[model samples]
Target: MNFFTIKTSWSNAEFILIKLCMASAYILIGSCFHDFFENHYSVLIGVFIITAIWFVYQWLKKMKSHSDIPY
Candidate 1:
């Protein structure tokens, strides 16, 4: 691993898992407002869980690889 080049000690499976996590984070963040638009408490809560799960799954993927969820 270097500034110009990248290398990961994690297995391919781990990398995929991390990417999935990051993606989910984004989805949750998007869904967060769905409740407001439709007025569904379940949607709001569901989004919250997704957001939280994605927040933690962030560690699954390499931070430097990509910002799966926008800052």
Candidate 2:
């Protein structure tokens, strides 16, 4: 049940599914409010950039952890 540790296939699948759903929701909402986004394009771009960086950081961290395993 740990956030960072996906020990089972089912848990891993669920985690991926949830992440995808959240990402999709973000995109869908942004597109749905295209006019509002156009008015605040800079802010929206900044938020997306930050989110992308954070996602990359987490991916790298996960990769590093897995690489450290003895298997």
Candidate 3:
């Protein structure tokens, strides 16, 4: 109801949206690389590293969300 409360709720919503975007991005990127790496194991390893980095970033962002913020 107050300004800070409203701001926090909005920020939480944004965080959720960002998490979704990250997940979709990883899925799409990984699948594309997987398909393209059929004959190249080295490329597949690179893709895995990139995807792992993305996952870590997303996890950190999600952890930043305030649990007290009202959805």
Candidate 4:
């Protein structure tokens, strides 16, 4: 399925399941890297920075695309 397509038929249970799975995956990955980092606090800070930059980048890209359309 395409990432941009809207699913009108998804139920609340399915949505919750998806969210739970994603959270589980994130925790698992973070735990895997916990041993490698000397300082756990820095890892969190780095994740925050990277996530913020990615969010801004996606927002700007979406805005640019919207601007290209004639109103």
Give the best candidate by TM-score: 2
Writing each residue's lDDT as its tens digit, candidate 1 over 10-53 gives 66765564465565556556756665444554554565566556
Residue 8, candidate 1: C-alpha displacement in angstroms: 4.9
**All candidates' TM-scores?**
0.35, 0.50, 0.38, 0.43
Q: Where in model 4 is the C-alpha error above 4 Å?
A: 1-39
* Tens digits of per-residue lDDT for model 4, 1-71: 35465223445654554454455446546866676533465555555555556555655665566655554
Kindly report which residue pairs in candidate 2 clash with one another.
none
Q: Which is the leading candidate under lDDT? A: 2
lDDT (CA) for every model shown?
0.55, 0.57, 0.56, 0.54
Note the residue pairs that clash in candidate 4: none
Model 2, range 1-71, lDDT digits (tens) per residue? 35566432234643553465466558647766676555655555556666666656666666667665554
What would you estimate as the lDDT of candidate 2? 0.57
For candidate 4, the per-residue lDDT at 24 reads: 48
State the local distance difference test value for candidate 1.
0.55
lDDT of 3: 0.56
Q: What C-alpha root-mean-square deviation, in Å, does candidate 1 show against the real structure? A: 9.2
Model 4: residue 8 alpha-carbon error in angstroms: 17
Task: Report the candidate with higher TM-score, 3 versus 4.
Answer: 4
**Model 4 lDDT vs. the true structure?**
0.54
